[model samples]
Target chain A: MNREHDREIVRYRAPTRINHWIVAISFVLAALSGLALFHPALFPLASLFGGGPWTRILHPFIGVVMVVAFVLLAARMWRDNRIDARDRAWLRNVGDVIHNREENLPEVGRFNGGQKLLFWVLVTCVLVLLLSGLVIWRAYFSQWFPIGAIRLSAVAHALFGLILVCSIIVHIYAAIWVKGSLRAMTEGKVSYGWAWRHHRAWFREVVSARRRAD
Target chain B: MALQSLDIVRRSATTTPAPQARGAHSGQVAKLIDVTKCIGCKACQVACMEWNDLRDEVGHCSGHFDNPPDLGGQSWTIMKFAEHEHADGSLEWLIRKDGCMHCADPGCLKACPSPGAIVQYANGIVDFHEENCIGCGYCVTGCPFDVPRISKHDRKAYKCTLCSDRVAVGQEPACVKTCPTGAIVFGSKEDMHEHAAERIEDLKSRGYANAGLYDPAGVGGTHVMYVLHHADQPELYSGLPKNPVISPFVSLWKGAAKPLGLLAIAATAFAGFLHYIGIGPNRTDEHDEREAEREAQRLRAEEHP
Candidate 1:
């Protein structure tokens, strides 16, 4: 029988875990508010955020919060996301992914190719949204900026919104498509078998800890 | 002599054979509407609703015959009326028909996660397949024009099919058919462009100097073009984007992240391959194991010595 004292090593500290949840929750809020502002028919969805005017008022603020939270998360995990030479070779054989032949593919450590790409894409999108949103924000910055700048910001905001939506769609699909991925975010843990199969390097680290304790 | 030579070079450059029209290869019939001529009767809206068999019960039917405030499950097309007072004290009305622009670089097509749910038909029309849609609403967010609408009942995204079934059989869209003012023209984009230019010139000669065609070279140029009479601003009219662009941030993200992601995967795989070939750096765990073995051997040697 497993003893209470014989737990595995911590993969993420409590602060790191909490920061992740903040970004995740804020992202959902921003996405929902964004969709409401995107169309008139969807304007009714603003009621979810207290109504149309409130939704509009709160959208940029929510975006700001999301950006701040994501920036913190990014700083903490930036090193893990850096691309290495081995990653290039893994990409060349990405076709194996389409066939569910990852067994023959490389064993990744903490984060895989898909996760790293998502991390960086989210970073770029959030940055663009925040900057452009500031430039075009009528309630706040329109008085301070030139007309041309405001116009350009409006265009940029729309464009970034489109890109972020697309990327998030792909991100969500990948999470759902891969069976055990959502559990990592939701429960903050994955099953032993799932970790061993998908992230074998990390799994080995955990196993070695067990042996040392024994 | 220098100015003359420059003029000659410019003339030659301008006269060079223009590249064959891009949309021509797609076999899609493009539609361009001259909004300057549209009287905003909304006959096209009625015709679209009837043709598509959309109902009035879905808050789509605006009283007084406007029958739809915006694009929704029951409405494929809408006519927005923008009225402004001219400097001369007379009121001018600019009417625009709102629907899918059927852009060459369709964001909806790019954004859809479910394959085959949203597709660009060979004819250049963006088509939707209900069977393949997971109803995730990605297309709703992807569209720059805010064209697609999702139904709460089934969660499926819907939008103008650009009358694909009718166009396939070589017929005009229902709205174009019902337009009495010849404002909504249905023809090749090239022909529509020429017609719109002539109409704009005619309106200008007749004293509407503000009259011009609205076709910005963005979204790779929308197939639907508009000619507006009000010279003030196009944004006052509904369904007109003040500024539209494929966000550079998206381009940068796609450019940088996609390659880096592939690289990360490749590196991980190469590490695995190295392990297989026995040339890799000792696996981290294996290195620890080797270190432990070395310490044990040293302890034995010390005892023997």
Candidate 2:
């Protein structure tokens, strides 16, 4: 690679990238296994997880893995994702952002308004899922809850799971919609141009910090 | 289950209609339990274990005649004895033959996630296909009557099947056949209703004015009807829910939520696909690179100069 292309900046550190992938991988497994139980049409997906009983056994454990991994990643990103006045303006101009006319929008940062919204949504959903999951977990905690609570938790679990899945669909779609975004999580770096175009404020900060260090 | 292959009216977690014609044509049956006549002899409980070949471990009593305290995998049926004090202060032992009510609308089947794990026979007997059971215990949560017991051994749910094995071959349930006091009777649903009416009339004539048949319409009328002397309070007979309906939450979760949630998910993905085709990807081209390099150089010059 030429020196020009070598000017790529760090978007996510190695630890953050690894933790994000752990959450991603576990989320996929948990969602698929959960969908297997959610509807009979999706029942065949159980075979991918060693059939129904095994799917039942593994889904909650996968969810726990996802939750723990996500908690770590979220803690790392929480400061960077705090919403501010610029983020609100950026959110208001989401139409332009989606259409690739982001020049007039507020200077985007390390995490955009949309990304912050998704982050909070994920945190809320993961918390709900963990609580409701315990109540409906048949092998253990279910007996502690009364039938009414069990019923409520079972319904809540499914509903939140749907919301989480939908939110993740949007998250995955956003990652693909923006070019070079995937590499931020995959290789832990983003091209200088990609960072400048997508997150100009963060790009300027990183450049000044690099100059200061030098 | 052996005879139900050709006549399943409903199958749990199955969206497609079951083999319906034969099951609909078959006459639904019922077991009438006269709670007024039950001596709490526990013959029915022993009959259940013997017929199903389930021998629960010999456990100590919890200071009551009810052995094992409550139903277990090996014990599909049990007599629940409740002492009720009348308005006149006379104590009455309300002995209810507690087991699966086998509702016309079976909640267990509705809540089950496994295909064909729980099936309703044309004759209204709901039987569990343990082989298909995933052992998540959703049925226990779904059951308004709280009848299903999940086996610790196999993790499969077990409950009173109303002797579906015997019913398939034109024989009555073992419990119905072995009640020495003639407290339990099995027949066509219509015949059972008629029999219940006669018993109710007899009790009313004997001054039990609140006597009535407990068919419980909230669950579309259970196949297991009870002739209760104090039917005004089914709860008095060991916490029978006053009106058992499939929980609104369970109904919502398994019903509209399924299709609506799927639609939302599909729409989201499709929306993304359409955007990809329409707006295309937002790229960071040479202009962005030039801008970044110039800004970096300006910042460096400002710092050094």
Instruction: Look at candidate 1 and tell me the lDDT of residue A147.
Output: 44
Model 2 whole-model lDDT (C-alpha atoms): 0.90
**Model 2 ranges off by over 4 Å:** A210-214, B1-4, B24-26
Model 2 residue B102 lDDT? 96
RMSD of every candidate to native, in Å, equals: 15.3, 1.9
lDDT of 1 by residue, B35-113 (tens): 7667788888788888888765556444543446767767778877767676899786766788888777776665553
Q: Return the top candidate by DockQ.
A: 2
| Residue range with the least summed lDDT across 10 consecutive positions in model 1 chain B | B4-13
**Where does candidate 2 clash, by residue pair?**
none
- TM-score of each model's B chain? 0.74, 0.96
Off by over 4 Å in 1: A1-214, B1-28, B56-67, B85-90, B249-260, B275-305
For candidate 2, write residues B1-305 as lDDT tens digits.
44546788899989899876676454689999999999999999989988999999899978877786898899998888898898999998999989999999999999999999999988899899999999999999888899998999999999998999898778999999899999999999999999999999999999999999998898899999899998888899989888999999999988998999889899999999999999899988999989988887787687677
lDDT of 1 at A140: 56
Per-residue C-alpha lDDT of model 2 across residues A80-147, encoded as one tens digit per residue: 88989999998999899889997878888788999998989999999999999989998989989899
